[model samples]
Target chain A: MKFRMYLMLPLLLAGLTAQGLEPLSRARLLADRSAVTPGGQETLGLQLVMAPGWHTYADPPGDSGMAPRINFKQPSDLRDASWRFPPPHAFRDAAGVTYGYENVALLLIDARVPPDAPVGGNWTVRADVEWLICRELCRPMFATVELELPVRDREVLFPNWTPLLRRGGWPAARE
Target chain B: MHKAKMWLGIVAVMLLGFGARAEKQAPGFELPDVQGKTYKLADNLGKIVVLEWTNYDCPFVKKFYTAGAMQELQREAVARGVVWLSICSSAPGKQGHFERDEWLRRMQSAKVAVPVLLDPDGKVGRAYGAKTTPHMFVIDAEGRLVYQGGIDDQPSARAQSLEGARNYVREALQALWDGQPVPLAEAKPYGCSVKY
Candidate 1:
């Protein structure tokens, strides 16, 4: 009886561990270019990284249950900054209509800084992103990302993130 | 000169073939209803048919149904001699999965007049590339897909937005009735992800 109990202990523990580490079904934002120009409206490209066999709800979840939302927090000096979302794909469930991206998606946000605002140093833009990821199951996750931009007058300084950011979902430049 | 003429003829034939293939007819499917009687798409040829992917539990679907927007659309569509099919593609264990009796109850409660098609296996859904509840597809009298996408311009889950949004189904049906081409055939759909 003692040996049998010992043998079952490891099996039971393994099951608990597996349940504890249930694969995370959430969206991870990977930004390729974080910097924007003072007088120019540029697109801040982001890639939604979804777990395999899982999908993140698209913006404006139509009739479905989940929607991915983005909240921006920038310094008061930075004005007229807004986020733009790419077109969403539709998914169906028994409950109704929903929108999301399966595998991965490239999202573009148009942001602008005030032309006459304070310049000459680095400015940090932060975003609080919330989204729901679902596969056979569903899970919600929240993440915060900070983007550093060098402020300048009449000049745009865009960061070079082609290698790492491209992997996430950034599209190649069109001719 | 003869060889050039032959090549041109071949090119024209290829172009015509490509055009025909591009306008391929929508695939036919048979799905069960709340009573388990199968509804076949082929049987409904020579008439306009609207296929609505649905999930009863989804808030977005609730927005339209609860607001009576979907029923209103259905009534108008049927008045114009259109057959409306509301399909549910939820898997057995996923949210929105329902038995025949439950679906009937829900549809009755929602005051839905259209036939509700049950696609538990999701085979029909996959065949149509249906990704969301409320995903709307319009088939013309010839049984070709004329439109596919959201039902309207507003993708919000709130019922209030329905009034302001342009309903695509109405527009497509109107265009087809008037013998005019549909101005918009596809639009990005917004809603919760389909639980496939």
Candidate 2:
């Protein structure tokens, strides 16, 4: 029985390692709401769940470090959307002060759809994200996320989810 | 096994304590300014000295200078007999590092009233562990580090926020003038990371 258990342990450990070994740390994309109107303004959420004691640089990583950069790719017919980064926390080291998020940071992005966008279909939204995660040392992480939303005519999608989308820095509407 | 664990815990505590101590002392060094005048920390004794690590290309630095926040601080500190040295530690080929003449031109254009020191090799910056553009430090008359860290609490790239945050340099100078301990000695400096 002992010999048989030993053989099983290696296989179990291998399976566990395989399950745990994700290239990047905790990364997920969440929407304030799962649904949206085809031609309306809605909030989209992107969250990076980093490993313990690791952090990503905030945008424009002023003299401190590299800030997180996001690239959104959608159909040319879709309206270009913008990302809202929250006020960043400052980091100080022997090198100087840098802006970044420690541990887990919630980065909120605002997405807009044209009023004439297609209705009654799922539209694909993809984002390529890159950031530097640092503890005592720094590591660069990249992730690509694709989200699908069910579109409806004029109906506000995820009305209840606005709070989650409001956490990061969002620009005021231009006059 | 219990004894061994106790020994391990003791070692861990000692290591942690050492790390804490390591974080407290200011980094050291020597660097020349825009005129090729070398400024060394040890030479500033008997005077209240201020160190402003700067990068001209950085927007945050621009905000302070363009808005007269840094100059105002420099004028005020100098009036109180503070030696304000603006040190640029940008490495060669980096964004902020410039020739002495170019640096002088930039300073003159910006109306910078303080001595603009150069650290092209970054020897002084590394010694003092100067990290960000606009990182600040205050050394007392006795040549002991009195205060080190950010210039203020706000970290925006906009000069509009300067009025709201408490200026660390001013506070330190005041404390020295009044013969009081600096109320807040160290804070997290915020700005563009020093291009080291």
Per-candidate TM-scores read 0.57, 0.56
Q: Worst 10-residue stretch by lDDT in candidate 2 chain B?
A: B18-27
Model 2 lDDT per residue over B1-196, tens place: 9999999999879744531121244445566667776777667678888889898877668778899888988999899788899888877887788887787798889888888877777777766656666888888887777787778876555455677778887888898899998888777665566776
Model 2 score (lDDT)? 0.70
Model 2 clash tally, residue pairs: 21
Compared with the true structure, what per-residue lDDT tens digits does model 2 show for residues A39-137? 666566677666667667776565464556566766433235555666677877646456767555667666666666688887677876666666654
Error of 2 at A41 (Å): 19
lDDT per residue as tens, model 1, A1-175: 9999999999998876644455453333433334444565655655666767777765565544456556677643333445455556676655345566776666666655566546776656676665667665455556666667666554543445554344434456432
Number of clashes recorded per candidate? 26, 21
* Regions of candidate 2 where Cα sits further than 4 Å from its true position: A1-31, A34-175, B1-28
